[model samples]
Target: MIAGLFETHLKVADLKRSEHFYGEVLGLELAHRDETRPITFYWLGGRGEAMLGLWEEAPENIQRQHFAFRSTVPEVLRAPAWLRERGLTPRNFLNDGTDQPMVFAWTPAIAIYFTDPDGHSLEFIAMLGGGPRPELGVISLEEWQSKL
Candidate 1:
């Protein structure tokens, strides 16, 4: 069985600025940091369950990237409110896109999309049970297995 994700490294043009935004505003705990090397990694967790990760090393003025996190339906709905208090805009998946949110198509699950400080698409979605299954991204069982 697969375990949870470790960390995601992002290259930020301004490390200090990204650090402040993620550490101060988002309130993620700094697991390891090296200012002289200018690399910092934040881990979001209480004991051993780390669900959030961040890095600052992207090139200057690059388009935002997307990263998704897992949560329960309630957490998916409530987290945005907390994030909004810190000035982070939460775009309901059901209300976004030229057509509609793909999240809704995956029934028994719910998700709320939002952007990070750098405009990167971040989604907190509830996967009914836990974690994501390959079928969640496929139209048919054959389509899912064929890729592998």
Candidate 2:
């Protein structure tokens, strides 16, 4: 049985730009940079915890993708402002202008969405300690807490 995700790859429009975003902006640790290939790697949580690979490709060849980083509830609460301070816009799951994390009633997880330079969707998510409430649908953290 699979324990957890170990790695994921994304096609980036520019390797250098993606490197700065992941290494400097997001603060992931640099693992390796291949000189023979237009690719770079970073450690997600800690060294050897998880890995993310960015492969440089032409814009036409790059397909947008989505992925989420495991995060804590407190960090998720602060994500919107943290992202804004870094010159990024934090968005809800629906991305309808609201800049707050939402709780998915089904999984009851909190998550905030954002995009990378190449428009690849990214997320910071944390699971909540509760049973699923699918009927309540996706709602704001405040609304989710009020029902608790």
- The most accurate candidate by TM-score is 2
Best candidate (score: lDDT): 2
Residue 7 of model 1 has an lDDT of: 60
Q: Write the per-residue lDDT of candidate 2 for residues 1-148, one digit (tens) a residue.
A: 9999999999999899999999899989999999999999899899989999999999999889999999999999999999999999999998899988999999989999999999999999999988989999999998999998
lDDT of 2: 0.94
Estimate the overall C-alpha local distance difference test score of candidate 1.
0.61
**What TM-score does model 2 achieve against the real structure?**
0.97
Candidate 1 residue-wise lDDT, 1-148, digit = tens: 7686766666566777777887898677777787667678777555356634445555664567787776666676577677778887776654443211234433435566776666777777665543445455523223333433
- Candidate 2: give the clashing pairs: none
Cα deviation of 61, candidate 2, in Å: 0.5
Candidate 1 to native Cα RMSD, angstroms: 7.2
Task: Determine which window of 10 residues in candidate 1 has minimal summed lDDT.
Answer: 97-106
Per-residue lDDT of 120 in model 2: 95
Task: Give the residue spans of candidate 1 off by over 4 A.
Answer: 51-55, 61-63, 94-107, 129-148
How much is 43 displaced in model 1, in angstroms? 0.9
